[model samples]
Target chain A: MLSVAEIINLLNSIPVGYKSPEDNCFNAANQMYIPEYKKLGVITVANELQDNLPEADENDLFCDVPGCQIAFENSASYQAHFYNVHRYLCSVCRRCLPTAHLLCLHILECHDSYFIIRAKRGDAMYSCFLGECKVKLPTPKQRREHCINKHKFPANYRFEQLCGKPYKRHTKKPSKSVEANEIVDDMDVVADIPNMK
Target chain B: MEVDPDEPKTSPSTSRSPTQHIRDRNRQVAQQHREEQRAKTIDTVRFGLGEVQEEVEELDELSEQDINGLITRITRRKHASAEEMHKLSEAFLQSMDNIKLFFEAPGALQVIVKEIIGLDSGCQVGALECLCNLSLGEAPVCEKIIHQGGRNLVQCLDSPDERLKRTSLWIIANTISTSPKAAQTVVQMNIVPKLFYIYLDDSGEKNIANEFREDAAVCLQILVMGKNRAARQEDITFIKDNMIKKCRNSVAAEYHLKIIFHADIVNPRNEFNIEQTHHLMDFILGNLYTTPDFGSIANRLRIVYAIRVLSNMVQCVPTTTIDAMRQQLRGVWETHLEVLLNKVFDFGEDLLSLEVVYLIRNLIHDKSPQPLPCQLDRLEVPNIDYEKLLPQEWK
Candidate 1:
């Protein structure tokens, strides 16, 4: 147990963190290591060494997959869950992963993420990058091949970011003034930005 | 709430087929029956007079002499049965006004407090149990219990007996939950520091005995829970929307929420202010005593609970809350950040680690604060990829 004096020393050692950072993405200027953090580092090392404590009985909690009949303790729950749940199941190849946490990683690295559509039914099912398109392929390259050969969808339309649900593109409204201007060769300043296209 | 720390590891004695054991069971039941009857009589005499249903309302109806007499009669007994005390305290809770009257009675509180500190662990635990039961939500009674030398409940925290420590911590938590005033009173007693001191007294492995520390965290939660603007916002909404749903036409929820949180709705007995978040931080950090868990799993749960309480405090406080808290102490954010990320890396899918991340995010980025949600909602990720959403710069 940390003694009163040691605890005081520890507290005194750690600088109160930066109150705020102005930079958006991430500012490494805000991150710093101190002696207190090293103490925490020691704690983590000890945590790893002492990590073998028996787990609490979680047999009662079922997998979060909707309609899943698997309680955590069910013999096949862990082993069969990949195929049991679509989130863990690679839709085209039918390969399964163990956990939802890993499923995203697996799909991103292995499967066809091009048609990245989420079918939120019993378990999360990742589809080909061209959302709502019927062509389900084992890999992104396969989906791209199928899209090129079979579908007339735009090349950019067939592509989507694979991670963190990529980005949701809401419908864009054509402005009435812009529509009238479109009768002419409308030059918008916003369109001048290369990425705006 | 789920862990029944009091439950025996082994089942109570049971045997069928043996006549001797059957007789022993019968005898024990009969003895218990006699005690219950005695407890019932004592309860009836003190509060059952002048219409039993209104006995709670009419507790002060007992002459001072009668109250004193009842106190003397109950105190003189060498061993007060815990069941009987539970029964009496349960009855006392019904008319909390009478509980105040009972405690305020010439010498009754002193007797109970004395017995609580007495050498007999059973008596001490029993008194704490009765007190905890009596003051569960009754603010006035709880206030009286704490101010009337009941703050001495801290003594029980130091006792060698685990049962006594548990019950005493529970009683302190119960009173703290009574209202913001009770919370302020308990915290002002430097309860957070005192508890940490006792918790680390063993000075061995940094394991916080869950039986004790979990409740200690709970007490800290109470100290901070209803004190913040969000809690008050939620409180006002709850009181108006749910507390007096039927009485909406008659009594405004705002009036009631203010009245209840401020003190008694009708009779604002004592002005009770919620303990400030900065003040709590001072206690938590200044007296922040801890034993190194050196990494025990049980200790991990304790850390999770402790961080949860801290996160709750963070959620309750405003952005300026951290600024004020930082004036008093530094390193809460970074210290927690290290511990939190470490746990997250060590134990993926840890809900507590997720909360700590948010707290760190809030502290690090100074994000525009959102309205605090209910406690359970805090555990879930805003989206499944919340982990991926974390800054890539994070180690």
Candidate 2:
């Protein structure tokens, strides 16, 4: 319920010209924002990129998984499919497990170091990895004991070190010649861990 | 009372006997029969025809003179039955000639407006529909309605009947869409907030239908997007104050953004000034990450809407203005770019991924005179692994 005069005032209050930037990312010598390809110092390569994906259908919901091409009639059906078939797909490692129980085990055994880091950062990391289980613990020791008793993890398994490493399932050929720094190495779990308490 | 031996005896507190039950049932049946006969008689008198189906056919075949006659009848007999008014309204909707005749007849607009204001909710809905159809006539017809019955039209928006409210909104939308003058006149009546309330108000006895809210949205769009600068200014101000500043409802904000998006799309000459555009961009970018429950369906839709609005705004503005805004709001842009890039690979939802891709496309392939450095550096085409990024099955 604004008065006409108030509305006019509000519209007038909007500044017309842009304010001067506190910190500018552009060089003062270059007035134009030049593209990287067109820069004088940069070397150019003619790479022909092809869009190989099919156009999306508005009426159907397509699964977003890399190799899954399943289409669902509605979000409900899609959600059901996601929970039934893809819920056990690990977010960190992308490994598909046979059951929620096995997925929980895999996460604990393979991603223990990541969980420890998250716990030290004060995140709520002690919740059961099984989607249906709502049990949460405040301390790492209590979480370990609960998992052993409830989820049947090995009683003597090492929880302080990362036991498994993620491997690249699919690799893309570099459009340009690869640089030395562009190559990614496997995670060095031992280098990351200090003295284990 | 004394009971005879031949008659079946019943206790005072017990249920009625079979004989009494049968007698009562007979009376109820006879009462139903009487009510049905009365209704049939009323229908016959209302249409002045034996059957309603026949009357509808006759209405369709109405000539110009017949249409005039209908208007004259409405003018003389202000208390026309709902069925008669409905038939006339439907006839007007079917033929443009009837609508022309409606405006050609003297005092036709006033008569209908009076009917809308004076009649019961049933008759008001019919009259409002007729007025709505008539508003779709030539520019003068819409103008005349705005000058003559504009208040009544706005009043109909406050009616309790959902259909009446819906038809009234449809009529206003039609009127405003006719011409800028008509739109400005309707805006002067200060009905924009009422439309916003209808669309955004959640406290109601029953859930308002989505169709009704959609009609309100369309009306708001027409007003804000119309060539009438005054109307656009007022509507945008109301949206800024209510939907943007308070941030009451995310869904409503989405609708408001949609109105702006459509305005940008239809009027590509940059209807929004720099300041308004800056405010909108900030609001949209802020909401992109601030959804209360991040991964729900509704929030996902809101994100899609935000992306579309950003894309359209970027396209509508000039290159220099974009460069200036980019310099002024570099941090906001950088954060949103990161969010958009992340959403592109969020494998849980395909629709969201597609919209993010479109926004990114707009950013990189913008029609600027020179490619923005931020866009060039952020995209990093050579670094992205296509096989790992997109679906493997597609390749």
- Candidate 2 per-residue lDDT, tens place, A76-165, comes to 335434543466666776655434554575566456677655555656556653333467665445666775565443454343321223
Docking class of 1: incorrect
Pairs with backbone N, CA or C atoms under 3 Å apart (clashes), candidate 2:
none
Model 1 chain A poorest 10 in a row by lDDT: A34-43
Q: Write the per-residue lDDT of candidate 1 for residues B38-98, one digit (tens) a residue.
A: 4323322222212334534432244445545555666666434544454445445454444
- Best-fitting candidate, measured by TM-score? 2
| True-structure lDDT of candidate 1 | 0.40
Residue B269 error, candidate 2, Å: 17
Q: Candidate 1 at B128: error in angstroms?
A: 1.8
Clash statistics: count for each candidate? 14, 0
Q: Distance from true position, residue B331, model 1, in Å? A: 22
Candidate 1, residue B102: Cα displacement in angstroms equals: 3.6
Looking at model 1, how many pairs of residues clash? 14
